[model samples]
Target: MDDQQFRQLLNRFGFSWSGYRKVRKGVKKRITKHMNALGCYNITTYLAELDKSDEVRKKCELLLTVSISRFFRDREFWKSLEKKYLPDLIDKNIEKINVWSAGCACGDEVYSFKIVWDCLRNSLGHLPKLEVIATDINPVYLEKACAGIYSSSSLKEVTEELQSTYFIKKKGKKRFEVNALLKKDVIWKTHHLLSDPPESKFDIIFLRNNVLTYYEDLLKKKAFRKILDSLAPYGFLIIGSHESLPFEPKDLIAIAPHSFVFRKEAE
Candidate 1:
């Protein structure tokens, strides 16, 4: 299909321009397959066919969903969260702590947070009431995440200590199983970042690599504002090392190097 029609088709599914470019590379094949299944030849005809049928819409969504992830993909970021942010947060409140792992593909990052919390809890003797909300727009990935089974490839960045402590060796394979205790603290749900209201304010919001890069400047600003608004006083916002919010609000204090941590300055 032409660029305009292609853009509109993807936009209808909540994808942005950057998203279209990132996905268009591999997606053309899937689009062709879906088109073949629907007996259409081009993206224009394929989208038209999909709009006419709910089954085709579902098929298209399944084809378009992206789920690339790994445990502790940025090792230093997790270390900083554990050593600096979590301790600071723990010191502030022992009763409640909320962490949101936005765009948590296959729940690796959610489990990573749980692992960090468990380590701190062991050393601290008592821990805050910790809750990790893991969200993704893809229902299929959310289901796999909730199932808590992962391939060894997904755990490449997981440290040896964590592998030994939090995962049991699966029989006859390179994969390790996620501990059940960590799973208890994490809640997986399908959430559309652009359309859905922030369900609750979080003490730490991990809106990592993928979602930040998939929008124009205006949408990026809106996303940053929304994420900031959902953060509590002294809350943390961690993005990919390369991705940054368009404008830094005065309220958000930079945490050196790359990260930004904010304290609520006004209601």
Candidate 2:
């Protein structure tokens, strides 16, 4: 589709310009493939077909959702979480600690947190009840994540020690399957950040890279408000290292220097 037509289509779905820009090239490729499958030779026909078919529209939405991610994608951020954040959070909460890994693509981020928590638990000699909720809008991603299998590349940041402890090498393959222990407390679901309400109160919300980076100002604000409301007092909100809040919530304050981690001010 042409730029104007594409923009109009995305606007209809409440997707912002920033989100469109991030995935424009990939969207175009997906659309062209779909158009060919539908035997449509032009953007006009394709748009008309998309308007009429719920399946086609859903496919487009999946195409636009950014899913690029890896296990422990940013080394330093995980270090900060394990060495600094988790210790403090564990000390403060006596009940089950709830963690929501929003937009958890292919489950790497969720598993990453479990690995860190497991390591910390070993040293502390005590552990809180832990429950992890991993959500994504894309069911395909959710399916893959549920399988808990990954290529060696996706595990690049995982140390040899961790890999040996937490993953099983597929006997004759390069892929690794996450150990069953790590999957015990994780719950996965399909959710849209803007349209869906918060699932539950969370001590830590990994609201990274996706919505905040792709959404326009208005949607970002709305999503941020929802996230803030779901956060427990003094809860942590972690965004991508490169991302910043479009407008900070009154109760959420940045906690770590040069990091996107924030803490909800306790009342």
Candidate 3:
């Protein structure tokens, strides 16, 4: 597609200019692949032909770029959560523990957190129903996540001891599946973080490596505001180690190294 057409197409999908810029190379490839999938070679012609087809739209959604994720992608954050964060939170008498894993591509992070939460619950001798709502804009990824299947590499971060306890190796080559216990805790759904409102206030919102780097300052601000607004009074906001807020406020406390968990001050 021509640059103008590409710009308009991304804008239609709520892609900010900065977001588009960051992913332009990937988008070009996606558009090219999309056209090929539709049996066309030219993007300009492809857009014109598919403009009226919702089927094309769905295919295009599948073609959008994404990076692969492995379980326990960041080990230190998981460690901190286990050693420090979870203990404090479990002491509370909350009725439900809601964790919203936004941009939860392929459910690795969702499953990882679920594993930790289950371990904590078992250790404490009481298990509260964990309502973990895993969301991503892409339907394809969500489908894969709900299936609870993974390649062997997804468990690379898990130590042999934990892996033995949490995963059962399948008969096929390069295959494994989550133990039935962890499978019970997660609910996967398609959600557009850019446009949709927070479905519920959460005790923890795990929005890692994906959000901040893609958008421009204005869009980033908008996302940060959405995240802040989505959190419960004492909810924690855990982001990737490479990410940080543009401006720090007293309400957002840096509890562990490189982890900023926000809590609304008690009135």
Candidate 4:
């Protein structure tokens, strides 16, 4: 598929052209294969198939998805999460801390958070319970996440100490699997961020590198509002380090030392 055909597909899904432009070549290759499978010779026929068949459209959306993540992506953010934010939440004396790793592709960020939480137990005894809801739009990714195995490259950002503590290397393989201990109590589900949140407030919601990165303004703003609303008062909303909020929200305050970390204003 050429750029024009790719743009048509992005428009059909309300996806951002700029967002897909950089990665469209790979995405188009996948879509083109899908089109050939359906015997669609051109964009027009593929578009028609998408319109009439819910199954085809769903598959197409999965093709359009871009999941490029690693453990402890953006080192500063994880440092802040561990040294500052998690500690502050602990000091609040809340008995339970709820976390939502939205668009949690392949569970890297979710497991990374769990590892940090586990580390805190070493320094601070008797910490509150952590409830993590990890969601992604693609069930295929969720399935892999459930398996808790990751490529060596995905663990590049992880320190040697962390690697020794949390992951067990597969025998003679470059991949590592998260310890079963870290996988427990994580809720993994297939979810579209454009829809309502998981019917629960969050102490910290990791909304990094998906919606704000790949959606058009209208969809981005709408989804951003939903994510914001689901954050409990004073709860944190962490976006991609390079991403900007679609609009200046009145109730969100940027945390010091990091522009990407925002705390919901107390109601």
Scanning candidate 1 in windows of ten residues, the lowest lDDT window is: 258-267
Write the residue-wise lDDT of candidate 3 on 146-241 in tens digits: 877888778889888888888878785677778887878678887766666467888888877565655556666777777777777677888776
Q: Please provide, for model 1 over 1-267, each residue's C-alpha lDDT reduced to its tens digit, 9 standing for 90 to 100.
A: 556756776676655666557667676567666678778876677777778989888778667666777888778878877787789878876478988888887888888888888888887778878778888878888998987788888888887888988898889987778999988977888886665545788888888765566665666676667777788877888876767777868887777654544444534
Q: Flag clash pairs in model 2.
A: none
In model 1, the runs with Cα more than 4 Å from the true position are 1-24, 50-62, 260-267
Tally clashing residue pairs in candidate 3: 0
Order of models, best lDDT first = 4, 2, 1, 3
Deviating ranges (above 4 Å) for candidate 4: none
| Cα shift from native, residue 59, model 1 (Å) | 4.8
Look at candidate 1 and give me any clashing residue pairs: 233-264, 234-263
* lDDT by residue (tens digit), candidate 4, 1-267: 778878988999999999876787899899999999999999999999999999999999999999899999999889888899989878877889999999999999999999989988887877888899999999999999999999999999999999999999999989999999999889999999999999999999999999999999999999999988899987999999989999998999999899999988879
List TM-scores for all candidates, in order: 0.86, 0.92, 0.82, 0.98
Q: Score residue 241 of candidate 3 by CA lDDT.
A: 68
Give the whole-model CA lDDT for all candidates, comma-separated.
0.76, 0.86, 0.74, 0.93
Candidate 2 weakest lDDT stretch, 10 residues: 13-22
Which is the winner by TM-score between candidate 1 and candidate 2? 2
Candidate with best TM-score = 4
Identify the candidate with maximal lDDT. Answer: 4
For model 1, what is the error of residue 203's alpha carbon versus the real structure, in angstroms, after optimal superposition?
Answer: 0.3
Model 2 residue 126 lDDT score = 88
RMSD of 3: 3.4
